[model samples]
Target: MGLTAEKRSADWLAQGGLRPTRQRLALAGLLVGDGEDRHVTAEGLFAAASDAGEKVSLATVYNTLRAFCEAGLMSEVVVDGSKSYFDTRMDDHPHFFWEDSATLTDAPKDELKITGLPMAPDGTEIAKVDVVIRLRRK
Candidate 1:
C-alpha cells in the first residue's frame, strides 16, 4: 500500500480512539483505504485478508469487526438474523439488500419516507430507525 493510504488507515483508527495495531491498520486499509463506502461480512473480510496475504485468522477478523463497531468506526447491519454486514459509512441512512446476489447497498435517503412511528414505552425515547429494503430480480 502507498504511504498516504497507510497513514490514512492509521489516522482513522486513531481518531476513533483505537490503537493502530498492525492487523487493524491492514484491515482498515482494506476497508477505507480507497476512500469508498462498502459493506462486508466477517467471512468476506477474512477471505480478502487471506487473498491479500494478510495472514489473519477468521476469528481475528470477527473480533476486529466487532471492535470497529464498538468504536463507532463502522455499523453492523444484521440481515436475516443469521447474517450481518459491516458498513463503513457512518450516517443515518437506509439500505437496499439485494436478495439474489446477497449484497447490500445504500438506498437513496431522499426517496425513503416514514410518516408515523409508535411512541416509546415508559420513559424511553426512540433511538434510531433502520430500514433495509430487500430486492430480487424478476
Candidate 2:
C-alpha cells in the first residue's frame, strides 16, 4: 500500500534530519505531496499555502525553506541578485531561467561541461558551482 500523506511528510522530514512540526508538515505537504520535482520561490509558496487554506506567513515560509536547504532537503538556485528559487531535486544539475516567463526548468546535467574555472581566493576553497542559463523569447 502507498504511504499516507502525513506519513510521507513525516518520513521526508526525518530523512532530512528535521522535526516534522505542524507548520513544516503543512508546507511539506504542499511542496512535495504530488511526488513531482518543482522549483518554487518563497512568495510563490506562501501564495500556494494561502490557496490551500494553510495559515502560514511569508516569513515562516522563507525560514522553513532556508532550514530545509540547510538540512539537505532542497537546493537553492539564485537567478540574480534579487530572485531565488528552491529546487526540490537536490542532485547537482543545471537550470534554465526563462526571463520572459519568470520560470525555471532543469537542464540536462550530463550534457553540460565546465572548464577553465578561476581559482578561489587564497584562504577559500571552491564549493559546488551552479549554472543557470537565462533565456528570453525572440
Give me the displacement of residue 3 in model 1, in angstroms: 8.2
Backbone clash tally for model 1? Answer: 0
Best by TM-score: 1
Give TM-scores for every candidate, taking all chains together and pairing residue i with residue i.
0.95, 0.94
Q: Write the per-residue lDDT of candidate 1 for residues 34-111, one digit (tens) a residue.
A: 888889999999999899999899999999999999999999999998899999999989999999889999999999
Off by over 4 Å in 1: 1-3
Candidate 2 ranges with C-alpha deviation above 4 Å: none
Q: What is the lDDT of residue 99 in candidate 2?
A: 93
Native-to-model Cα distance after best TM-score fit, residue 133 in candidate 2, in Å: 0.3
Candidate 2 global TM-score: 0.94
Could you tell me how far off, in angstroms, the CA of residue 122 lies in candidate 1 after the best superposition? Answer: 1.2
